[model samples]
Target: MGFHGIAKAVCRALTVRQDGPSLYDVCDPLLLKYQGGDPHLGKFYRTALGNPALRPLLRRTGLPALKDAERLTRLRAALTAARDDAAPDWTAIGTPVAELMDDIDVRHPQPPAAKVTARAPAMADIDRAIRVCGAHLLRSFARNGFIPTYAAFNLLGDADISGREMLMALTGLNARGYKNSTLLFALARIFIAHSPARALINPPWRGIAEPMWEPVQIRHRSAYYDAFFTEALLGFVETGLASSDQAGAARRAISDMVEFCLKTSAEEVPSHDGSTVNVITALAPGPHPRFSRFFAQIKQDLGFGIYVPDCDTTACAFSAATQAGADDPILDQPLVDFYRGYQVRAGANEPRVTVPLNDHIDYEGGVVTWIDNLNGDRPYGNDLDPTLNLDILEVSFRNLKRWKIIETPQRLQTVHRIIAFQRRLVESGAFKNPRSHIYYLPELYSAYFGRCYAAFVALPLAAQRIIDPGNVFALIRARVLGYVKDELIAHEMNPFDAALALMALAHLNAEIATFTPALHCIVQNLGEGGRRGPYKAYEWNKMKTPTRILVGGPEVTSAFALMSLALARRRMAHS
Candidate 1:
């Protein structure tokens, strides 16, 4: 047999254990004729294949051990199959309606001997902090008006994805749903944040505008965050934050974002009818390599780019465009159809296709993260995230209401299904556990949930009729008060977390005292010169690994701080 044949037989013979990473994972590239993609593993595999001594050892002993291990894994899974497939008790998580109104305080008890040192920030301090933060944000804006987002190695890495920083800053500023008139200066500073991204959509601003500085890992300027930028800009427009000319610019940016989403579909997949269709239903986190033909070749050869579209970005795009009055009927059906097709209905399909699963069936009705070109064989694409599903619920409702799109039975069914999924997911307290979410920290998840709930509730009573809010408000309360509030009182949260907490509390209309600590946290963290905070605001997960990328240094943190402090000021003045 040839070397390729021997490699395939060896891989097949290799044993994979149910409990851990296996030789199969290591040898998959050889069997599949694709590169492993992991740099460390790639090096190891090359050595194993080339070294004659290693090859002899692998053939003589390694293959049999691998075969035995695979057999054991299969046998163990078969033994637990019956117990694992049983559905979780969804009703058991439901709280009594009466109890939902009752406040459950879980504040940590402080020692009596300890003096009360942390005071609510004074009004003047808050105002000054806001000004300082706004100034910091303005200064952080690159020449092209983009805010830098960094990741942490030992400290924060270099400007990783500025688009994300801009989005988070804008989201924090508008968290209270305040009019743009009140935040004119801050808004003006951010008005051009989207321009660099928009320029990427229709380029040749090459000489005129400096491209946003990003690490080589981030290929496209849009890079999975255009929807977020689109939504942020649209928020400015709706809140009268943008002037006529600015609004026109915002709309143009929004158009570019939506068009980019539609045109970029990773690759085509075979439709149910056997004809191939561009899998354009969702927006991908891109490394599209549109700027250079060289990187495109690398992407094709090494599979370095994230080619699959995700539901979260797609939902953001839909809501942003719909609200911005960019009506595109062509996008509607495929999007609805993609969700319907990819939404999980049974056991984790294609186990060990990417990550290993131990026969759990809890993720029914939640849309999988990726809409890939795998047709029915989407093993890697079937991961479920409650946070992303909640995003879908929030954006879908907004889009439907804005366009007055006639909802299909399938569409309504999807709405009900994901809502059910979210309710059960939250009520079971799984949502509170950081392990349950793939991409977000628990506090971040709760903050987003609060923001989403507030937006949904604000939809006019007529528009709110589409999906029942059910116990979402109660869930938010439980999460914020029972869990998040305790964490705030006990721990020193970063400015980003504090800002998120402050806005969520504001949304809840909780007593000013409930979030004053968060406000104080933001105020006290202001670095000398008040240009930025002493801390970082956000840290993004790199592919859900332990290694986190710290996003937004002092400047980004200050942006969030400025917004939070401004909101606190407004609330305090009223009080």
Candidate 2:
């Protein structure tokens, strides 16, 4: 009988329920009809039913023992003949079934026996990484008057630093000497380019005007850029880094950008509405009370919760809620809903849930063309969205605890689910594939995976139960360490990936010894003008190779490198 027929027969014979308690439950209704008419068949069915779990095994293994009266008589005569001849030949029954049985056994083999060792990093190693990365940044500044937008490119090229990248660069050079001055001058050039006549600050993409800096255009402009720059500029004014005129200009620009973003209708605002909400929330507590009002208004219009249409939107919402305040239902509901939406029931338990980071495509698209949204509510599967999902989990865990959004039991359960999902992905070798998610290139996989590892380490102790319930932590730790050893140490590391890897190691409190070689590699690869090499390449055609495209300029690379080193230094100090 075919497997389906066998399943039906077995289900009927065993009185098993269809759509039973668990996913493994199997049933059908025909065998009972045969059993009612024949005592012999009923007796055979009772003997063959065996274990509930093993019952399905017979379908694939075949029913060699099951025989009609005619077959049984023939088998008995053959056996008698063989016994008389003193040569029992079983080959006449059928080809040997041992090979098939062996294949079945192999199909469900045990998990691997490999154990991963976690290495502790030393303070000296961290210090060395910081020193090397810092020295590299200084070297680049000495070679070029201004940092190139990309580590590998000469001049600014097509890339320009966003306000957020600029802010990070400024933060990195806050106390440094001549390098600080160069950074300030670079900031001044940007301010000059975005003067009233140019009107580049609030536009979709701002380009640096020629002569002073590279003439480069930035697209997908939004209020977030303005808010980030405003925050940075105001910081400069507070530190007395900016002159009176510069401060005045910054204040005016901040006011204008805020007005532009808030006054415009939601329909009128650029595509990334979630980003707009996040930027506004980020500015809420900082010199802009109006930001809070705008945040509330947007939330009211969009409804209470993280935008489910995309992972970035959900992540941004979680981040905004965490930053907003404590016990605020408006901000907290979205996170709670988001967590609930992605939770999947596991095993026989209703409460036992797992958070699988599944991908959802919002639209289809070309490189430069906008992704067409044929169906906004539907989410098709892809391999790349999991990175952002993990990102959301990381931010959610940190903020939810800090803000006390949910109860302890619920929070722990959510954390456990996230960890389980991550462990399954890593063990299944999904991370090894270079599938494109948001970015066009496969190289971004490592960067996102690095971030996922960082998130794993950032979880609280209750949420990080890898030893008792499972050794998921050790497995993830091994994979992360291996990633750093392979991608960061063995190969040339890009600033973005390097930054992410460094942050992951720091978060895990991994031995600085493990990452020192990777840090050194980054230092060695530092191009002229305080930059790193081979920016992320994006392409439209699947068959065509993508060109190395620089993003956010030298400031981004330098900022990330400095931030990584700084994080390492801070961790070492505390340790």
Candidate 3:
């Protein structure tokens, strides 16, 4: 079908904003003609929701939030609403349905810092390690400021600009008072250089340039990376990391990221019987080009095509934007809009999806990875993950309390539900299960969980009570510490994992002795040529392929190592 036909079909499907969009619309005979009646309804579902691996991560019972009778009635009402409300717009734009789907395949489509004092035996050694790692990172920094050393897809090409590792190293160095150093200045300049102030194709955000991380190999700009880079730069400015010359550029880039986050958010209106219906808001990853380029080359690089709105990116964006110092209160809308919206709960309308290598598990309360339920290769973004939920909690709660924003009932309810959900994950041993959180390596997840938990507890008692009501943080803390012990007991962690564990311990303020094992792990794994040892931080399914892609390299490993040693040293001296 052509654009007109597709527009008409969408208009018909969304007869009323109250009833939500209908997947049944894809079953219409007219729509079926486009796919040659291949029973594409299920494909549409899978595409929009997720592949088989992500199917089970959603709430199983009471899905879709509409039964046959109710669905049909709503569909009919939607048709009526289309006839009444959207008819004029369709007539004016003058679009036809059959013309829209002729040749369209809709599938496969943050941080901050600070500084402190230091002191001197074990401390001296830790300081030396930090310097060593810092030098390794500095040596690996591309003249362009990109950390090309971060290997992805099992290859570390000079063209690969790994935003994740770049930001990690930048912040880690800044934490050690390297913010004003020459290396950081060069890196900050790179961020300033890549941020495009020009207008974008999709969502048409203006007034600020979006921070686009163009990984030469992937050849696409990532919204997640954009928000992440923005958040990191914001932290740099906040902590006096960015030099005076770069601070203005950093602020402008942050404004760009905030704009991108707000623009990329998708609004889902659920069908409801009550007089008031709340719209669900969440952030989606983007190639966000204009309509003409939407389907030119379908690259399924991250399993679920391109349009899935995930909690990880959402949380990152929310946290970044909340701290971005925007004058508009609307920037905080996600805080209010995300209430019980995308999370797994009773009566949730989201589609269920699963994760591989650990699929047999069953649990709920954590937020699903994807929140958007549109008809992409993965819609209804299903699946709960410990790290993703923790991310959401860290950002949402911190933002809410940081700004002292008054809580509406919906916002309040969302916070409580997320806490309860995490409690369930922790108490049920889901938090410790590698299969439960498929995105990160086991040790890496432990590190992230510990760090996020530390941040959560650092909040006021009233805020901490949200999770501490059932001693949830206590259990979570124990689980994190237990994992640290396990890593030490095995005494076999790679340098990256060792560094990650050390960072977690430092974040948790564990005793100085707890730092010994991880420090040894780092020392033992040191590369032969005076380089940091090689390690893989995490892996994910490549788009359209079954192959799992690994991402990490010596630069990234050293980055973490630097942060870990630096943090451990500082924390110990303070203690």
> TM-score winner among the candidates?
1
Q: Each model's C-alpha lDDT?
A: 0.46, 0.36, 0.44
Total clashing pairs in model 3: 28
Off by over 4 Å in 2: 1-217, 222-309, 320-330, 334-336, 342-384, 402-416, 436-460, 466-468, 521-553, 572-575
Q: Give candidate 2's root-mean-square deviation (CA, Å).
A: 26.1
Per-residue lDDT of model 2, residues 1-575, tens digit only: 34565455555434433221111111113222232232322222232233243344222321222224454344334323322333323233111211111221101111122223245345455444444434433343345422223111111111223332223223322122211222222322222232221122112211111111123212222333332233333333343334476556545544554443333211111132232121122122222323235434432332221212333333443443333222333343334333433344443222221111122221111011111122232112211343544555555655655545355565555656665666665676555443323322223334444454555556666655531168775786677667655544444344445555666676566776665644553454445342243222111111100111223444334445555556566655565
In candidate 1, what are the lDDT values of residues 1-575, reduced to their tens digit? Answer: 34565455445333322333233332333322333332322332333222343333233222122245654354233212211224312122111111111221111112122123356878877766665554444343323234344333211111121223222222222111111111111211121121121121122211110122222332333323445455444444444434586567656656765666556533466544455544443324434323246545543332233344566766666655555666666445445555666676655543312221211335777776765565343323335667777677767666664434335666777777777777777677776565466555566566667656766777666555656646554665666566656554345554566776776666556678777667766777667323234444344333321112223344445544554555566677788
Question: Which ten-residue region of model 1 has the weakest summed lDDT?
Answer: 174-183
428-460 per-residue lDDT for model 3 (tens digits):
766655445545544666666765776677777
TM-score of each candidate? Answer: 0.57, 0.41, 0.54
Top candidate by lDDT:
1
